[model samples]
Target chain A: MKFLEPGLIALDVEAADGAAAIRAAGQLLVDAGAAESRYIDAMVASFEEKGPYFVLAPQIALPHAKPEDGVKEASVSLVRLREPVVFGHAKNDPVALVFALGASSSEEHITMLRKLTTLLNNPAHVQQLKDAPTPEAIGQLLEATTN
Target chain B: MKIICVCGLGQGTSLILRMNVENVLKDLGVSADVDHMDVSSASGTQADYIITNNELAQSLQGHAAKIVIVNNYFDLEEIKSSLQEVL
Candidate 1:
């Protein structure tokens, strides 16, 4: 029941800009075999087309593209940036955490999203995730969140 | 009550907003049927309220449902205060 794997998790990654951060997150999905390389391009295109609407919370972002964008599996990659980067979101700027979603279908994405929503709704759990020391710690935090 | 959370992609951020809204409603002891939809399908959908970000709020103009612009999608207090006026 683990949506995040240690290999796909990056803590305090350094990026030049928001796009770089997104690319780094997308790379995790690529490395995990969840998504193809074009999926990263699609994510960037989606961000350009949709603006900062992907910033779901004050310090969190959920970047994704259409399922047709080249998803090979249903999963998500977690990226914690060393320094927050701005994605033009007026209210929620300088995002520190990025959750890149890659799903083979809408249903798969929705199912994963429901679990994510439950985990993120609790501020305490979110703080735990943000302050997690290692990828193992992050995985443990997510494990505690699963019902 | 019926509420539809709208976002550009619908499945990603909208789902989170919908979850948050549902939690707020439950805390208020109110019953509601909440749904999530993309911006493309949102305008034609039927609902009492359409919750979305400030950007999409403008995009959904002239829609049937009352638009609720939620700036901070995760801010339960802001969402509660805004829903208080309408719900």
Candidate 2:
């Protein structure tokens, strides 16, 4: 299955930092029926404890919590930041995109993580995501990655 | 067999990295088990090696396990080389 389908986008988030973006993205994943509501808090707590590796590359963030924290399903939540947020890492560049993930088990989670990482590795796609203006546009961008 | 423990704030990302490491080990025909531990509990574990990103590995200094800090967990080539060196 395509990890990120059209319904996963929650565009135009107004989070001031990585922590808030994680919470918002987690909530969206829950609302999209991809994860349990409790997973949102767990994801936020992980960020609080670990700082943000989610801020992998410039302007990109991929925040996630553990499966044991309470994941009902496997899915991803995408949020485009209105303004960049500093996550306090050495790569403390402001984060413009947030992709919060939820998985039911370790093996399944890792598979999705691999795909997401491969996607993020593409500079061209990252640039497109940064420039996409609407949720629909973001969805199209993700869909294009599937090919 | 070398055992590598990969921990994150929780075990989520650690587990993902562990799986990737496991795949790398398999391809190399190396005998190893890459396990996941929560960052809180990772300090107490006994392991032959520890593979993690800069942030978490920084806090695990002077542990019994030899730590290898990776720039990104998804970088399979880097992880494979580090594991080979430790083994």
Clashing pairs in model 2, backbone N/Cα/C closer than 3 A = none
Candidate 1 docking quality: incorrect, acceptable, medium or high: medium
* Native contacts retained by candidate 2: 0.20
For model 1, the stretches where C-alpha displacement exceeds 4 angstroms are A106-108
Residue-level lDDT tens digits of model 1 in A1-147? 226789889999998877888899999999888889999999998898878788888889889887788888888899999999999988889899998988555576667877888787778988988889999998888777865
Q: For each candidate, what is the lDDT?
A: 0.85, 0.71
Question: Highest lDDT among the candidates is held by which one?
Answer: 1
Q: Write the per-residue lDDT of candidate 2 for residues B1-87, one digit (tens) a residue.
A: 556555565445675667667878888998775677765577888888887777677788878888876655555777788877867
Assess the local accuracy of residue A19 in candidate 2 as a C-alpha lDDT between 0 and 100.
78
Name the candidate that leads on DockQ: 1
Per-candidate TM-score, chain A: 0.94, 0.86
For candidate 2, write residues A22-67 as lDDT tens digits: 8888877877777778888888887887677656456766788766
List model 1 lDDT by residue over B1-87, tens digit each: 789999998767787788889889999999989999899998888888999988678889998899988887767898999999887
